[model samples]
Structure formats: structure tokens, C-alpha cells
Target: MNRKLICYLLSSLLLLLNCNKVMSASWEITYPRTSSDSDKSTDYPLKVLALALEQTGVNFQLIPSEKHYTQGKNLSRLKDNREINVVWSMTDRQREKDLLPIRIPIYKGLIGWRLFLIREDMADRFKYIQKVDHLLKLSPIQGRDWPDTKILQANSFNVVTNINHSALGPMLSNAQGDFFPRSMLEIWDEIETLQTDNKLIIQDSLGLQYPAAMYFFVNNQNRPLAHLIRTGLEKAVANGKFDKLFNQTYQSYIDRTKLKKRKFYRLKNTFLPSETPLDRKELWFKPN
Candidate 1:
């Protein structure tokens, strides 16, 4: 080969190798973890995130942050693009303004369907409550930083706030609060895993409902990632994978809740952003 042709061929090969290296590099996606290593609530959302990335045919690694952080701290990290790149949280106006949201409700709006976790002996206290006003008379315990606290308080419910999520269960057990309202998707497993001496049970007959969306959010600068996640989630929904995973993970809980039989008092979610995709009926869960 001529010397000029040989030099050109070597340069082309090096460029091709660099291009391949760039294409093969995997994006490292980090998610936050709570203090509890055994938190099962994170499992479904993690799986859904994996499914979304899988749909995109992207090379990526899913990682849990080594340092435990509170939900508020995790969100702060996400906003700063520090340790965590993505976090799943219930959407509110402030959060939407702070981060780039995927906009697809990861929990299919089930996070707003709440069941009261009350002392087993306190069952009759709620039995005769016929209206939301009556229920409002009972104070519910919630995390101090959680949006649910604001939402509950906004609706005139006297809310007991604790800084720690793990403490809420103990507070409810110790009668520090009248009840602990938990999402239907969460209450079952939480009750099963609670290590309190007090016997807590899901309140029967009465429930509360609101419109909320739990979405995966990234830093505002990470628009590519946000778009990638939204595209994958939408494609999953189109091909039936999203619903399949949703049912597989939560259908049993839904069935156990007996949603259709419960008398649910609907409450207004003032924290819900106006841009929420409420018009998309298929994205939400409705009890038959």
C-alpha cells in the first residue's frame, strides 16, 4: 500500500475505535435508598425503571446510592445532579419546577388511594363516620416533609407530623396520632412488615381518594434522560407491558383492598399541578 493510503487507513481505524468506545459507554443511573435496607416499597418502582430503560435499547447501569438519604435529601441531590440522577416522587408544583419530570405516572395514580391504618381496637371509632367531615375530626400522622402532610392539612384534617417516616408507625402504635393514612399499594406490605407491639389493621368500610401522580424525575439539565424515560414508558404502555407489570406487582393488593366495596371520600389534591395528565383516563386506576 502507498504510505499516504496506509496513514489514512490507520487514522480511519482509530476514529472507528473511538466511536465504538463512545457508543458502548453505559450511562450510570443512580437512585436513592432509605436507611432501611429491606424497604420493599422500592422494588416495584425499580423494576418499572428497569423496564423503561430496557425498552429504549440503551446501555445503562441501575445503581442504588451507597449513602442513605431521606426523601427530601434525595430530591435535593437529584436537583443538584450530585449523587443521584433520578428519583421517583409524587408530583407537586414546586417539584415540577425544580426537576425534569417524565410525566408518566409510575404508580398509575394508585398512590392517592389511601386506607387508614388504625389500631385494631380503634375500628369502631371510624365505623360510624359517615362523612369526610367526621373523618377530618380524626388526626392522621404523616411525614413532616411529605407533600401528603400539606395536602391533608389543606383539606382541614388535623395532621400529626413527624420528621422520620420510620417513626410514623411507632407513633400510630403509641396513640400519638388518631390514624396513619397510607396508600393502598403500600399499606398492606407496611402492616405486614411493621415491628410494633400495637396491633394495626387496615380500616374497613371507609377509605380516602385523591388525584395524584408519582413520576420519575431527573435534573432539569438532563432533558435527554427525561425524554428517554418518557418515551420508553409510553412505548411500554402502548405494547401492554406497563399494564402487565402494574397488575403483576399491585393487582393482589388492589384485590385485597376491596376497593369497590369501600366507601371512599374523595378529597381535593391542591398540590397536584395543573399540567397533570388527568384527561388521560387510561393512565389512572378506577375501581369497578
Candidate 2:
């Protein structure tokens, strides 16, 4: 064929293929695989995103972190590579500046509040920890690079960190830290996994309160995907689907924690980004 004719034919074939192809973006999502629940590959916000993505016609493949990496490492890997397109993390001024934040509080700020897990022998002492100063006298265990660790330290609680999530149990067990604070939703599964060590006990009467939230952080260049996910999430929240999912997933924990009855030692979160939607009270959960 002559060059002109060959070019014409190739262009026609390309046009035909384009007409038949479905519009889809293949998204790769990475989540930490907790030893407690394998099925919880996607936390509540990601769950909403998965549903939203389906409505938006994007194809997604969620893969658990093949190698265990901390949230800090997850954000680091969210850059450049297509392997990890989204990372779920709390919004701090620094993180929002570094990554494209979805700006939605995925769990309605429930994860921001904390319950304590101390060594069984220290449970009595923690119960008597009636003030912030008392808790500050001893260090708490936190996952290294976790936003909670920074928040804890910032709020004047001494925090000792472990890079390995699994090691927090041993650190607490060995008296490396006085307590490990966990969310009401997360404590049950984690404490059960660590119970065999016989060194930890859930504090009965007190809770730590803070204004915190978890949000999805996408690379700055990935704004298109961020918009897609954000639009979907907004729609979900507006139409009440998001609230339904939130309650279904976490109401039991709210009941279990008896959040209102517990003596909450409230602390301020100085690191919360100014752009955070704290005024959107409807977006946050309040104990009934």
C-alpha cells in the first residue's frame, strides 16, 4: 500500500477500536493487612469509594500491602508509581500539603477518639488516671509514623513508637510503654489477637478524646482520580447512603464503648489542617 493509503487504513482501525472500547481507569489501591481481619481490606471510607467508583465506571483493583509498611511508608510509595494510587491517612497540615486530600472524614471522626489498652497489671493504675497529667507521667505505645503518635505526643502525652504494628503488643507486654491507645472500633479485634500473650487489658472507665479524622491521600498529580472519588463520596453523603453505611459498620462499637458515659479526657489536636470540615457536624458521629 502507498503511504497515504496505509495511514488512512491505520487511522480508521484506531477509530474503530476506540469506538468499541469501554471507558475505564484501572485504579490500584493498597491497604494494610491486619492480622485480625483479612476481609477488612477496605476500611469504611474506602468501602464508600469502592461503591462510588462503581457508580463512576472506574475499574479498581485493591491489593493488600504485600509487604507490611507503616502509614508513612504508604504515603511515600503513593508517589509516581501506578502500583499505589491511593493511601488512607489522617489529615495533618503537612500531609495535606504533600498529598491530594479527599477532604472527607471517612469514619465521621470516630477513629479520632481513643480507648486505652494497658498491661493487665497496670489496668488499675490507668483507671485512676483521672487527668491528662497522670497519663502524661507514663508513655503510651503507638505505631511509628502514625498520625495518632504525633497527636499523642503533641497533646503532652509521652509516646513511645514501634514501627511494626505487631510489636506494639510486645512493647506493651514487656512494660516498654504503659498503654496503647486504640479506637473503640479497632480495640476488640486487636486485643483478641494479643490476648494469648496475657499481658494486656482494656481499661474500663476512661477514654481519650480528640478531634481527628482519616482521609484518602492521593498524589498531587492524581487530581482527576481524586475528583472522581470525591464527587462519588459527596453524592453518597448527600443521598444518605454514606450515613447508612457508617451506622451499619460502626453503631455497635458506639454502643459498646458507651462513649457518653465514659470519663473522656479531652485533648486538643493542634495538627488538624485548617481546611478540615469540622463545622459539618452532620458528617461526624455523635453518641446518642
Provide the overall lDDT of each model, using Cα atoms, as 2-decimal numbers.
0.90, 0.79
- Error at 208, model 2, angstroms: 0.8
Model 2 error, position 28 (Å): 4.8
Candidate 1, 92-184: lDDT as tens digits: 999999998888898999999999999988998898898998998898999998888889999999999988899999999999998998999
Model 2: CA > 4 A from native:
1-45
Model 1 score (lDDT) = 0.90
Q: How well is each residue in 92-175 modelled by candidate 2, as lDDT tens digits? A: 888888889998888888788888888888866776677778878988899888888888888877789978877888888888
Runs off by more than 4 Å, candidate 1: 1-23
Error of 1 at 242 (Å): 0.6
TM-score of 1: 0.92
